[model samples]
Target: MSELPHNWVKTPLTNIASVEMGQSPDSRFYNLNGDGLPFFQGKAEFQTVYPEIRKWCSEPTKVVERGDILLSIRAPVGPTNIAPEKSCIGRGLAGIRSETGISQAYLYYFFKNIEPWLSEQGTGSTFAAVSGQFIREINCPVAPTSEQARIVAKLEELLSELDAGVAELKAAQIKLTQYRQSLLKAAVEGSLTADWRTKHKPAETGAQLLERILQERRARWEAKQLAKFADQGKAPPKDWQKKYPEPLEPDTTDLPELPHGWVWASVDQLSESVRNGLSKTPNTDQRGFPIFKINAVRPMIVNFLAIKHIEIDKSEASDCWVEVGDVLATRYNGSVDLLGVFAMVKDVPVRTLYPDKIIRMKPVTGAGLGKWMEVCGNVGLSRKHLVARVKTTAGQTGISGEDLKKTPIPLPSVEEQKYALAILEDRLQSILELELPLEMAFKQSTAQRQNILRAAFSGQLVLQNPDDEPASILLERIRAERAAKLELKKPSSRKAKVSV
Candidate 1:
């Protein structure tokens, strides 16, 4: 550690603080009914200074007093929050208190400086965690009380400004997202092609195109049935076409009017099939067929790297295998944000199947159908439709295959669909390019925050006043006071023998 400005003391936390590790109370004491005190388990709702209280404890155990530093100690280790009031903390956290001559704010800032190092040092098998002994052994640079206060005051001033800048950048990114979604909505509704429509006319109107596709859809089904009948060496059944299930038509009651060459269509009318994938729990082994986790499907982005290898053969999971141009939709999720998200299968380098929590929609060949479906599913109205149908059966927010098949979307003639998608892609690519620098700036600002903390602790941020007492003298007084306190707690020899 760099030398502190003339009067600071660098010492292990044992000298200037006490560590109180938390322990969970009985399950019966845990309640959401606002019983006794707010309960904090891990880092679920942790924020800048304090954790937002949700669950409460009827009977408190392992409590932290107000202003104590609350440290997360399990799974994700080394983050800290402060206690706003006396509250119960579970095994995931430990409370720290500053001793005499040290500011609690200074201690909190010191912890913030060392977070990166602490994260690396945490150890465990199932979940990485830090022991109380590890926390106590960490060295903290202590500034004299007055200077500590000065440093904290300056940091808060500078950091508040930095935080504001970061917040603005985040808001900008959100605006980009909204703009992207709006572009897709406009493209599908033919707003983007309004000028193009005045110049170029489609050979087939949207209604006529829909009629042609429906005829093709039925013809394929009839051919499959005919082949089956021929294999049986018997004549085809009379009126076999009557047995074909008609594709679902969209309900246009509440839908808005489409452009002259466009019409509303159900996903079922546009797609050949809507089906769910395979389900096998405890199937991550990095061998056999690759299976996509729900995370692999984000809005217009599918990452094959976020996949697991399940111990199932390609043959056994044949029906679940995804081909190129297929659309994957998140069938169920805990977060509603992911409910209607869709991504197209660009390439299957290795054959893969999706989980049951994902629904696959294979569009009728030709007409840029797969990409159009992916775009339509992620549009604003479709998102609202999917969110409205979400059912929470046993703690999951999700949609059914039937829901995907019945969702309404605008359909344009094949020529117009291709043209709109090309324009939308060009605009969206520009937005993606702009986001690159914004994402990097967010990361850089976070590093700058750490730099500010480093400067403050190194005594480069605030000046030292020679009139202030040196930390060594303050430490000696604190030590003496602790020794006196320890002495008073000891039993005299005569009393000890009597008790024994």
Candidate 2:
């Protein structure tokens, strides 16, 4: 502890405030129809600075009056907010009220300062929680009444300015996200490479490119069939054509218009093969083969660190192994925001498999096209289509493999894609550079708020006034008043004997 200014004193919380632990009411008495007192269970119901009333209790067990500080004591411990109205608090919360000499606002700020320490002292087997004793035992630096008032006022003024800065930083982050989406939207719409198209016309249109991809696919399939025949020690069958069915072209009547050389194609038409991965649970052994889960599929890049290990047979491993340039997508997630999210695999150090919730797409046109497809998937037009196709059950959402295969993609000439990607990369890089400083500013503002609170409680935020009463004298007066109140509540000895 740092040395305090003259007349300032260190005081335990129990000396200056009353702490009340909450008891939950019976579940049968709970209702959402506003039949009784507003109930708060924990921090899950907390808004920016208040608890949002989601449920009510007909018979409230532990009640807190308006102006009392409500503190969460379970799991995420020590976030403090004021009770706006009289309400019932459940087992996960505690109510605190300041004594006569201490300002309620001053106590709130003091609790805010000690929040981190309170969180550290929390204990539990599954979820950490603080006991009622923890709240009573925490010490605070006390100043004279007049000084505490001045300190709170000054601290609020400083924090309000800091909050404004943080809000602006968050607004910038939203703008950055919007700007990236706009860049991708333009790239897919052919507006980004409008000038480049005039300088270098495509040698072949998208329709012709599709023809070449189909031809390549057929050639590869034929070669595989012949190799299988050789492995079986037999000649190629004469009627093999009757058994093999060619890939089907998707319906294009409802598709949107594209640029002169661009065409609309489904993911199935552009990719060599699109397959979902294994559904088996992974083992805990670190030496097992690494497999990518839904979390590994981030925007534009796969997070290798998020991969889990699995023990698999050699045949299953061979079928699921992912190659560099394979585009992976999340097939299922509880959040709609994560469904249909794409990530491109840039490199694989060893054999890697992906989980059933992740689909791997190997594009015949190479990694460059795969990257372009990933960007297209994130833009508003494609995102709307993908999200519309998603089916939801309970809290989880999923898109079937067939629905994903039918996702519309705007096909640009390979050259134009390369050019547009180059421009988009440069612009996106600049936007990211701007975001770094804003992120840093947010972190710094949080630290500065903590610094302001540190100064306020340490008798340094405002100048000490010698004319004001010292905190020690104020504490003695409060103790004397409390003692007198307790004495008044005691039973009279003469009356008790006569009644018996």
TM-score of each: 0.88, 0.86
Name the candidate that leads on TM-score: 1
Q: Could you tell me which 10 consecutive residues in candidate 2 have the lowest summed lDDT? A: 241-250
Q: How close is candidate 2 to the true structure, as a TM-score?
A: 0.86
Report, for every candidate in turn, its global Cα lDDT versus the true structure: 0.86, 0.85
Candidate 2 achieves a global lDDT of 0.85
At residue 488, give the lDDT of candidate 2.
100
| Global Cα lDDT for candidate 1 | 0.86
- Best by the lDDT measure: 1
lDDT of each residue in 110-144, candidate 2, tens digit only: 98988877788888899999889878988878899
Q: Where does the lowest 10-residue lDDT sum fall in candidate 1?
A: 491-500
